[model samples]
Target: MPRRHLHVTGAAEAPLRAALRALRTELAVPDAFPLQVLVEAEHAAKAPRLPSYDATDLPLFTIDPPTSTDLDQAMHLSRRPGSGSASGAGPGGYRVRYAIADVAAFVTPGSALDAEAHRRVSTLYFPDGKVPLHPACLSEGAASLLPAHTCPAVLWTLDLDADGRTESVDVRRALVRSRAKLNYAGVQKEIDAGTAEEPLALLKEIGQLRERLEVERGGISLTIPEQEITEHADGETGGGTYELTYRAPLPADGWNAQISLLTGMAAADLMLAHGNGVLRTLPAAPDGAVGRLRRTAEALRIDWPHHVSYARLIRSLDPHDPRHAAFLQECTTLLRGAHYTPFRDGDLPTITTHSAVAAPYTHCTAPLRRLVDRYASEICLAAVAGTPTPDWVLAAFDTLPDEMTEGGRRAGRVERECVDLVEAALLRDRVGEVFEGFVVDVEDVEDVEDANEDQPVTGTVQLESPAVVGRVTGTPGTPLPLGERLRVRLTQSEPGAAKVRFVPVVPVDPVDPA
Candidate 1:
C-alpha cells in the first residue's frame, strides 16, 4: 500500500491529538528519552574528536520528504570505466557512494543512550508528530547526515557492472558532507522535465536496470496506492474536519529504494561470508497460494492466463480497478511469517533469503532511526576490515530479535488504530446515507456473536469516496461475492471505539457480456 498522510483542522484537531496521546499511553510508548541519555547525547554532540576517516570533499546530496528532519542517508552516483573495457575513460560501470548516519560512533556500548535505543527499537511516526527512537540532539542534529555539515557516517562504496550487478563493496566510517537537500516531488519534476543533474539524472536508467534484474530473480514488487486521512479547518464556519486522500509513490522513490536494497544485499553477502551477523528472512510462498489467487481472479472475472508469471500478472493490473484492489489485498496471504534470524562464527543461518527481495538481505542502513541497523553496520565494518566483531554487538544479538518483534507489533497496532479512528470520525455525521463501495473481503458467519447477527455473511467494503474501508453486512439470501460493486448505507460510526458498520442497500447486477 502507498503512504497515507492525515490532515485535520479546527475543532477536530484537539480531539485527534488527545486520542493519539491516549493511544500512546495505552501502547506504553515513552514520551521522552531519559535525562542521562539526553546528557550523553549533548556531550557526544559537543565533542569533536572521534575515530573517523575524512571524505568531506565528496559532493553528496540527500533526497527525502519536504518536511523530514531526521535525515539518515545521502548518495553520489557516477559512471566510470570498466575493468576490462577498451578505453579507460569510457563508461565501464557505475560507482555509488552512500553515506549513513553513524549513530553507533556517538553512542557508548553500555551507556543510557544505547539502553534507551534498545528499548525503543525504531521510531514510531504519527500524523501530528512522532515518538523518536533517539534524542533529537543526535538523530536530527550532529549524527544526522544533513546538507553542508560534516558529519560522521558509515560510508558504503559499491562498484556495479553496466547491468547494475554488484562488482565490489566497501564499508567504513568517514566524515562526509552533503551538497544539497532534495525532496521526492522536486527531483521527480526535474526528471520529467529532462533537467535533472548528476545523481538524480542517473536514477532512472539505473533503477530500470535493477528492476529488470529483480524480475529475473523472481522477486515481486507490490505497487499499491496508499490511502491517507488528513485534517482541514474552515474559518468561515468556525468548523474543522478530517479528509482522506490517496498518495501514489513517484518513480524517484523506487530509484532511491534500489540504492538501499543494493546496499542491504551487499551487507548480507559480507555477513554470510564471514558467518557472524543478523539477517531479515522470509520463506517462499507456498504452492497452493498462487492457485488460490488464480481462483480468485476467475471469480472476479479478471484474466489470469496460465502462462503468466505472478509478478508479471500483478504488474499488468490497473491499480485503480476495484477487482485489482481486492486482488492485491488477497495477495497479502502469500507474504506471512517474516522475521529476523541471527548467526555466528561461520554457522550458516537456516533461513538466509528474504523471499520478497529474492536475495539474502539485512538491515544496515538508517542507524539514526532503527536499533538493529547500528549493530548490523558495526558487524559489516568489522567483516570488511577483517577484524574481530565487537563483543557488545555480538552479545546484543540474543535479545534484539524479541525486542524488535514486540516493538514492531505495537507500532503497527497504533498506526492501524489511528487510521481507523480518523475514518470513523470523518463518517460519523453521514450515517443513513448510501454510498458506492466494492466488496474487498468476505467471511461466512461462524456464530451469532459476530457484528451481523441476522445476516449470514459479513465482509469489508472499500468506498469510492472518503477512501474508507470498513465492515458491512450482507443479506443471507444474496451472498456478497468478492470484487462485487454495490450500494451500501452507513448504519453506525463510533470514533471512540474506532468502529464503522454498513449494510447493503441493493443487490449488485452482473456485468453484461455484449
Candidate 2:
C-alpha cells in the first residue's frame, strides 16, 4: 500500500476531476474546516506550549516527497563508541536521533482540534490532493519540522549495535529544528555520487543493515511503484490536462523507510516494557490473498518455489522491473489486515504484531498525518518520564481501534477509486480491443463472489500495457483459470462510475464438419 503522488503532464482531466469530486461528496469526506477550528489553529500557531528541553543544535534532517509541507519526523544518524556493556553502545554501534512533531503541544486534549482529529482519525490521500488531518496553520506550520523552524518534538535517542540490533533507547520532549529538508532522489544522488555528508552516507549503510535484519526477522517490505498523476503545460496551452503513471520505487525510499521502521520498533519495545500502549497490528494475510499473489507472481513469469516463503520471494524481487512492480501493486490486498489495537494494565492483545513486519510495531511517527501516532507518541513520552498514561488517552483507547479501522477503510476506498478512475479514463477509447492479461484471481475460493442468479462467472484480470485490473467475465460455469495468460477485450470503461470490465476472447472453432 504505497501512497500515490499527482504531478502535471497533460490529458483531458475535467471528467475525471468531476468524478473525483462526486466521489468525495458521496463519501461525505470532510472538506473545509469549521470557522472555530481555523480560529483556534491560528491562535495556537503563534503560541504553542513549548517543551523545556532544546536540541535544535543536533543538525537533524527530514526526508519526504519534495512537495511535502506537513513535515512530521526528522533525524540525525551517527555512530557511538564502544562501552563493552551489553546494553551500552555495542562495540562502535550507531545512534539514531529522531525528532517527531509534538502535535499534542498545539492541540489540547478535549479541544476542537482534538475532537476533529479524532473524528477524521487520519489523513485521507488521493492522487489529486490530500485531506489533511489538521489545519495547515499547525500541521504545515507551527508543528511541522520544516527547515529553519524550531518546533516542539518528541525526540528519540536510539542506540544500536554494530549489526543493527537496538541496544538502548531514550525518549523525551525537546525543541528541534531540521537542518535540511531532503527528498529520496536527492539523497540517493548524493550517496551514489559519494558527495553525501556523514549522516546521509550513514543512511545507506544502516538502512542496508536494517534490511538484512528485517529479512532475518521474517519481515516483508515490498517495493511497489506508486501511481503518479501529473499535469503538463505547453505554456500557451490553456486547456487543463493530466497524465497517470507509476513512479518506480527507489533504493532511497526503502532506506528512509527502514529508519522509520527502526523507530517504530523501538517505540513498540518501550510500550511493551511499560505494559501500556496501543500498537499498530496486523493479522496474518488470509489464504485467498496469498493465493492471488502467487498467481500474480506466476503471471509475471517469476518462479516461486513451493518451499520459498512469500517474504523471501518479495525480498528477492527487483522492484524496477515492471513485472515485479505489477506484482507488488497486487500486494495491497495482502496489507489489508493491518489495524490499531490498544492495551493496558499489563494486558497485551492476542495478536500484537504486524504480519508484514513480523514483529511488534507501533506508529509513533507521522503524527502530523496520522491520528494514532499522536496518541502513541504521548504514551512513549509519558512512559520514559515514568508518569501515568494520560487519562484522556486511556479513555480514547477504548475507541481507537474502531476509529482507526474506519479511517483505514476510507483511505482504502479513496486509493482504489482513484486508481479505477485513472484506469477507466486511460482506457475509455480502447473498448473492444483485445489485450493480453493474466488471470490473477478467481471470484472467490469457495464460490463465485460476483455470481449472477443465472450464471456464475467472474475473476480479476491484470492487463499488462496499462497496469489495469478489472472483472473478467466468462460463459456460465466456466471458472477462469487461476494463473493463465488469456486474451481479454475491454468491454466497459466508464470514468464517471470508475468502472471497467473485460471478457475472455473465446477462440472460434474452425472446420467443424468432416
Model 1, residue 195: what's the lDDT?
98
Clashing residue pairs in candidate 1 are 2-226, 6-229, 6-230, 7-230, 7-231, 8-231, 82-92
- lDDT digits (tens) for residues 1-514 of candidate 1: 1145554445534666667677788888888887899999999888734555889999999998786778889999888665533224336778899999888878988999889898888888766677888899888889888888888899999988777778899999899999999998899999999998867788887787788888889777676667767677667655557778755567788888888988998999999987899998989888877777787788677888898888888777776677886787678777777788889999887889999889999888788878889999999999999998899988988899898788778777767877777887789889999988878877734434544545657788888787898898777656776777778899998576547899888664532323
In order of listing, the candidates' clash counts read 7, 10
Root-mean-square deviation of every model: 3.2, 4.2
- Lowest lDDT 10-residue stretch of candidate 1: 82-91
Off by over 4 Å in 2: 7-13, 83-91, 233-239, 285-301, 321-323, 433-439, 449-457, 475-487, 505-514
Q: Once model 1 is optimally superposed onto the true structure by TM-score, how far is the C-alpha of residue 220 displaced, in angstroms? A: 1.4
Q: What is the TM-score of each candidate against the true structure?
A: 0.92, 0.89
Candidate 2 lDDT, tens digit per residue, 1-514? 2376754333334666677778889887999888889998999999999888989899999999898899998999997777343445345778899999999999999999888998887788765677899999998899999999998999999888788888888999999989899998999999999999988899998899899899899999978767776544545544244466657778889988999999998888788878898988899988877886786677558899999998998888776665666677677678876778889988988988998999999988899888999989988987888888888889998788898889878887887787787778778878999988767666554554544655846887776566677888877756676556778889999777649899888851111222
* Full-model lDDT for every candidate: 0.81, 0.82
Residue range with the least summed lDDT across 10 consecutive positions in model 2: 505-514
